[model samples]
Target: MSTPEEVAPDADAVTRFDDLGISGPVLAAVRDLGYETPSPIQLATIPTLLGGRDVVGMAQTGTGKTAAFALPILERLDIAQKTPQALVLAPTRELALQVSEAFESYSARMKGVHLLPVYGGQGYGQQLSALRRGVHVVVGTPGRIMDHLAKGTLDLSELKYLVLDEADEMLKMGFAEDVEQILAQTPEDKQVALFSATMPAPIRRLAQQYLRDPEEIAIASKTTTNTNITQRYLVVSYAQKIDALTRILEVEIFDGMIVFVRTRNETETVAEKLRARGYSAAAISGDVTQVQRERTVSQLKAGKLDILVATDVAARGLDVERITHVVNFDIPTDTESYVHRIGRTGRAGRTGDAISFITPRERYLLKHIEKATRQTPTQMQLPSTEDVNVTRLARFDDAITAALEETARIEAFRDIVAHYVRNHNVPEGDVAAALAVVAQGETPLLLNPDDDPLAKAVEADGRPRRDAKERAERGPRTERRGRGDYAPYRIEVGRRHRVEPRQIVGALANEGGLGRDDFGAITIRPDFSIVELPVNLDAVVLDKLQGTRISGRLIEIKPDRGRAPRREDRGSSYDRPRRGDDRPGSDKPRKPRHKR
Candidate 1:
């Protein structure tokens, strides 16, 4: 329940894992895992944790914080006396399983060491049997840990180390009490290491009450996204997403890739679409069996699979070295998920590319993500038709070269073709051309791309452009009479909620990041309200407005479906202004009575 003051390190002393005095077996396993340089968190926290001091590490998600405390625990554990020497608590079952898997990987050379993951929705018999057989480390969620403790099945009496991974997320999921109960069961002398992306007040209080003077190590998140990654996005309407994604897959050269979607349904749909286009693709989600998930991931790692379409939950903690790109088929709902989505690539110090498909209305989310990650994404325009043709032909050439390599005896066939040309008294070029036509199957070898619509209708920024024909067909029309550059949007708040125009405008300007000039009209009805906002609003601005409150009511803003008609569709002050009038007119200037 208490910790001692942290032992401070000497100034300006830099050390590697080897210099930090890690055991030979552990260091060997680390090197075998292909990690040469230590991350900043590892460099700062490893020495202290190795020195048997309680430590608190603050770092972003993909910063290799796992190895910082994991290695020290591995080095300190006695192989023979395996009665749960260490307990690493994670927030979710996925994270717990990943942590245990990592321990197994790092302890490859450490014989007789067993790490078990205990979490909810899993059988107790396996965990109980593993305990009976004596496990060295137990990684799990707090709820299951507390269950074992209450049942007197887990022997934390012999536990020497405790780790709280992602403490803030744990607290958010209402595990604070369980964590405290579990901590109280461990020996007071146990070395506790807490790592969180953020140190919220509750976690700070928990640390203050539980951890002895802990060494504070904070690694500020980078001001920008990983420089090793080339980030770009494609803007297309929601309906055109599949076509756009197919075109990009045709143009981009990659080894293996993961395409992230938002829903379980979408994972299958996207993967099927890619498969129909001849991609070796698969879909994964939480609904799949563990065996299926493992097989899918194994296929991805072994280069048997080219594209994996998955939802975030199914893809958590997946580390595959062959992953060359991560495509966000649908933008993540939040920035933290976005960071983790891209982190699947650009690992092991290898340069990677991350592409996303966004609609025009969703560009605001791009700006929101940019402010969150400190990286401005460039839009990838559609590939030119000629460019696509060239790429396809090059692939065809590669296919031909590979086929020729496999057909070592094609020389005889070539001689026969030469004999045929001579006998027919035809040009050799003409004979070769006939063979190519036969080999091309249904698709032509040299396609004329001049008729491609995207050649002229796609802008550099991925936005749609009108061609001359379309522009000529849709003749010009007069602009709206009132509200310059503002479009009518409806909100749920209304006269029933005592909504007011000034309150709506104030909320839009202050909470929605809109200017006063951007608002034009506001009308509150019995159950809904309509307001005007500048056209082409920023995504962040729209999101903020959607969550804004006036009179303690949520402003769920959506495009006005041509505002509901009233007896006065003939004359509403906010709808439109009359000619020769400086302002909109109403038949009844005095506010009408409400039904409620």
Candidate 2:
């Protein structure tokens, strides 16, 4: 019933969480999490919530909305009362779990406080046990909460506070009826907080129907994309993405990065590939346990991990200040997801970068994202071998400079070098070069320009050499055996693992950082597969591919010295007949001898 209040965009206005009237325990927890200043949404909503007035907050997903509502709730909680006094309803299981985790972190110093997250896919027995033991706060999805309410397992007679997070998403998900039912069961006197990115007609009507004359707070932004972040997208073929990513990683100076992918399997695949390429990377998905996910996030925050491969659900409500880059490995289908994925970086007015991989067919999605965000991403050029070499040389120089700071250690090494030069009657320059070679070890100091597919793929003007779709249609060219362009290499995954040629090619291309032209014919035998690769493949690259996995089995690739393995038992007699098999006089059986 009241006009919405516009919060000042300047976060510096509010220096501390304590200034918002947050209690000592809650402030302690905030400090523990390294949060110094309150966000605009928090500055506007926390005081109002602490004053016991209902609040309607309008903000985007990554604007610290969880903390905005959570801090106030923690400050006002009656820890001694074991019954659920506060309930938070979210649209998805991921959001519910995230909210519960936030509550847990904020109440770490507070004793006698219990929190439970209830959602589908989790055992009901766990919820029943937690309810019987009594909890101070309950965070859950509307459907599961409705089920519990219908079964008379949850009581809201004494509830004091209720919050609906991402209310617009809940409505979009068709949870309006369940949300209304849950709201009807709550106590009439309970304070409510509704937060949404956008308020639709139905949301407005629901607020009018349920909420008491609430104070409205809106955190306005001119655009969805952060101004501090440099947005860029590279037009690359699907097969060339990993190589492009590796080249970018070699060139960009980033403290931490999150590579967003579409599916749970991609998180593991990408993370595994990155780790194989000598990166400190880990994967987080719905399948990963909450504790492991938390640990992985914590490691990223602490700078122990440099890269995190994550799905959208696993990364919900993730706030880490050290995240300097966000890579959309697979572009999101929806614009909102794109916004959320890139929102992980450029937080708190810090500078960051967002790079996306856009295939030719997915170019339309980029246009949609640009239209929605009102910001066009600049076209990015894949780093050339020379560019990577420059970066490598600079890093090598910096390492030497850093080592020079340790005078005693450098002197020791210098004396050893001098002794070697004197004993071998070799020039000091040659000795230094030999020492540099020793220091470089297995990894090459400079990437071979000829082996750099990304450099050749991108033209001088920063456009792909050929259209991705056209190249895909043309397919990989067959290798001429004796011309020395391709050589046979054997991998350990084959028919036994139901491994397909496409899978082997994908694994090799991604892990080995090779292009489509770099691959030759692939033969899938019973126990192992023989694939042709560039004869000039770097030994280091081969070593890296030795750890490449297909169907969860390590490839362990080695040069194929002997002839190709026989494929005599390729087709089984028990296999079902194909459509054409029964239509003509084919050697294949019309029917299986027995049902497989």
Candidate 3:
């Protein structure tokens, strides 16, 4: 195995499929699929890969990396044989299906070619049967592939080419060990190609170990800022973020929008909330069916849907040119993720917009994002009551103008208004006022100021104060707590695993059979966070709380130290928001954590 030096770009590499050296059948498939010139990565890697050489290509997502490897892999396939010869491993099930579809599209002219995508959360009987029946290509995740290999259901003994798609993502998802174990089963002489957006240390080591003197191709990242994309953020409370998002949706002129949330639960919740507010929004998460995910994305691309709320993992390889806005409903956890999220828009030289919602406490994360992007995100002020009213009236006016311009028959309505004046003997001004009221009623003009809670709250805080009246009777508290007695426990996880105080508090309150009030003073220092719980609580509760998750890590909740550190007593320490330091806001207050 040897490493090939960087090769100069083939003159025709950037050309359209017809002009490129791709065969007649491949050209026909490309034409039918309606794709034009090759993307940067595709231009650089396709030829090398087609020549039966191993490849290590580094390119960002949505840069047509799929075709970079797929086109070449399909070109080398023997149409007569239906045996599994090539295997592709993707990080997620969504991408596995996509890669399989790409194989089908690229090999449309090949007779007796079969490609199967096998992944978890899907039927195994069908996959086993497909493998037995004969498939030219197999795409799957690492874990499922390992399972198939162990079951003797997938045959890699005759495998000639292996592709690790999105290698970096697989590592991040804790699939590094599974990937290495699966790779050990492939034939020693097989051609290996690895592609990733970012080359972390582990991936670099893997490539060095696996690839035989492979050709290295690195497509330079698009470094120039997309001036066409107007990036901005709105500082709003967590409770008011949905309202803030609704206001922007209502007022902004967008062709299509993708709203990203952190969790799968939030994707559904946010989508449902938008639907209740009358927005044509859909949700896409890992739990959704393949058909549902396809339908949701297809609808958005076809102009039938206006907004899609999706998680980062679920929205991979999503390329829709009509998407005009990308909303970070929840700030992305890292800089690279933020880049990918915003890259969905401002395509084809069309101007786009990305707006993020940052809470006061999370403002520091926003600053980090700005630094990563090398551009400050403009702060978006809440829409004032006057602004909302003005926009509402303008919409009404636009409707009237549209009706007058487009309607062929307005004489009847005009005559009716004139007739009303004559019959009622009312002044012309009064009749016009009545007509305006009726016209406004028929329009889709939602002018309630409080509909935007953030705006309303800001406005309320600005005005004269009003005293609130206490309820006649106190409502029942959710949980009762003991004042003095407190129990303590410790978890195995520490700062290395990224555990935080709130995560521990939430985990304990929800899983430990401890009510909100049952938790006493909480202290989170370096390594671990200590929480005070009711002493002598049920042994069953203690047993359950032990082995509970603090921050995605099982903890051993036991006893705490006698002397607890007070919150105000401790000097201000480093606080990193969940969004990481790469979000918005200024980094004025950040300091590196001090080591003991």
TM-scores for every predicted model:
0.47, 0.49, 0.49
Instruction: Give lDDT: candidate 3, residue 22.
Output: 76
Give one digit per residue, the lDDT tens place, for model 3 in 1-596: 24433333344444775444577677677765556777667776777777777888876555567777777777778766666789999866546866776677778777778899986445556887888889889999775676576557788888888999878767654466668877898898988899876777778888888888888787654433566888998876555778778777767878999999876778889999999887899999756888998998899989999998987667877889889999998875345567778888997798899998765434545544665566788887776655767877787778778879755467667788788888989987898777777766664455565555467553432332121121113322212224456666555656566655444544454344233335555545556656667675656567666645443445666776656456544432332222232122223343434434
lDDT of 1 by residue, 528-570 (tens): 7878776766565676566555555556788897735766542
Whole-structure CA lDDT of model 1: 0.73
Clashes per candidate, residues 3 or more apart or on different chains: 4, 0, 17
What's the best-to-worst order under TM-score?
3, 2, 1
Off by over 4 Å in 1: 1-14, 223-278, 281-324, 327-373, 376-596
- Report lDDT (Cα) of residue 484, candidate 1: 51
**Which stretch of 10 consecutive residues in model 3 shows the poorest summed lDDT?**
464-473
Off-target runs (Cα >4 Å) in candidate 2 are 222-596
The RMSD (Cα, Å) of candidate 3 is 13.6
User: What is model 2's C-alpha RMSD?
Assistant: 15.3
- Assess candidate 3 and give its lDDT: 0.69
Give Cα distance to truth, residue 361, candidate 1, Å: 25
Compare the candidates by lDDT and give the number of the best one: 2
